[model samples]
Target: MMNILKRVITVLLCLILIAVAVVYFYMKQPQFGALPEGVRLERIKKSPHYRDGKFRNLEEKPTIAEGYSLVGELWESLTKDYPRTAPKDSLPSVKTNLKTIPADRNVIVWFGHSSFFLQLDGVKILVDPVFSGKASPLPWGVKAYKGSDIYTAEDMPEIDYMLLSHDHYDHLDYETVKALQPKVKYVICGLGAGSHYQKWGYTGRQIIEKDWGDKQEVKPGFTIYTESTHHDGGRGFTSSQALWLSFFIQSPSMNIYYSGDGGYSTRFKKISEKYPSIDWAIMECGQYNKAWQSVHELPEEVAQATTELKAKNMLPVHHSKFTLAKHSWDEPLERISALSQSKNYRLATPMIGEVIRLDDPAQTFKQWWKAVK
Candidate 1:
């Protein structure tokens, strides 16, 4: 009995050591990204929002809401039978060749999720592009829907400014950014997010790393302002090593807003006061759940944020491509469309890769998902 027990213990110890070794090496891979260090870490320490060794939100909300446990949420997400979490068939999309689109045209093209391209006063900007087909560190996780990923890095036009909202996997995919490095001129992201780009071979000169309320003029009359939002980001075990942010672009003809990913807070009203005349706002509205009400806004909060900003038109994003939450993929679109009827903003629901004329407020979009599944 003693001999058998000794053998079992030896085998278990060896297995435990192997598991630890595997994880250590896996995390060492470049995809997990480097944490804020050296000059970047020094800059992060000086931010007004930095507190207790991590960047803090103006509104202090728990990552998971009061009553939920992380383990419970994960179990429910895995075990629960959420109906239609992904479309039953290939989602309908219009692939207007991006490279062929006239450079002079003022437009916005959403590549689904939070990735999008914008041309204002002839300066082209791409935001949070994740074309790696998946949104996780592990290869098989959260794959993009069939037709949603038709747009690749090779298809993109020359990008004057690439806006990386934060360092989260879905927003900042390694494979996607590396492929577009040659065509991209500058990358505008929050304070420490530049660390990841630097590791991926993007020149430090090509990155515009800034704090919460800093502003930059990339082109004549085209100013990009980095603003605060209530979200968290990190690629490795230590999270919120950098600030999470949104952008308010002041173009010569019009103004635009992009909320990368954030929960609902009083910050929206502050943003409206700061940039009083917003032409169009692209807000994050998907992959939200009740437990994460303070992490990503529930659909109701998304509607309220739009109202507070008083945007002339709003394009609801952060949905329709990947399933990060348990809700049906079409739920975000369906809910927000219903809520917008009484709101001040006209909801712009363009199909994936379809060009939307920024000046055309009267343009209409089909309830495209209704026909898909």
Candidate 2:
């Protein structure tokens, strides 16, 4: 009987080892990406925000909100009511020909989630472009909504600059980067994020990684200032090896602020105090829950942040493509729209691939998601 018990224990150990091996193999795939190393590591360590081998936010933040148990939240997310997490029908979208967009026109087109195409002063900039149709390391994980992926690399024109906010799978897709490599001129991202681009075949000359508070004049009339965000970054099991950031883009014709994935913080007010006036604020307004409130902002908080930033107009993003949270997919738009109305904040709600004329600050879009069901 003792021999039989030992045999059972041996079999269980073998099974556990096999499972661990499988997981390790899967994580080593190119999609998981390489972390900052060697020279990149040295550069990251120089930042004042770097501490104890990881970058830190302005203040200490918990990944999960106060009083929330990580295990309990995960269980609830796995087995809770998540109605309308996806649209019932294909979402409505316009297929704009990027190459044909006039060089003189300043326009912005969103491709759902955090990806956006910006054309100003004949310079084409693509931000957090994930046109690969999925937002996860595995193909089945975090698939995009139907009709949301109307734009692809093939549809893109020669890009002047590609702005990557962080190294998260949703923001920095491996396949998308490879597909756009031939047409891309420069890759701009937060500190240590260029390691993944280097691993994926981009040379040092093609990438520019900046720490928080770093400013660069990319061109004669265009300047970029990196600012802090209340978030963390990593492509693999580790976290915060690189910085997460928002960008204040100053151009001759416009001033735009992009709040990469972040929770509500005093940083918004700081940005307003520094910039004085932002012509357009592309803000994150979705994929939020109390469980992860410290990382992502609630819809009301988005409105408050917009007000704090002194932005002339707000374009809500980080929704309508993938359902990362349990709330109804359209809930963000509904809530932000109502809040903007009550607070008298100007809001821009363009459909996927619909061109937004930057000069027309008063331009409005139809409630496109209302017809999705």
In model 2, the worst 10-residue window by lDDT is: 337-346
Candidate 2, 66-106: lDDT as tens digits: 89899998898888887888888998999999999989999
The true-versus-predicted C-alpha distance at residue 311 of model 2, in Å, is 0.6
Q: What lDDT would each prediction earn against the true structure? A: 0.90, 0.91
| Pairs of colliding residues, candidate 2 | none
Runs in model 1 lying further than 4 Å from the true structure: none
As for candidate 1, its clashing pairs are: none
List TM-score per model, in order.
0.98, 0.98
Error of 1 at 328 (Å): 0.6
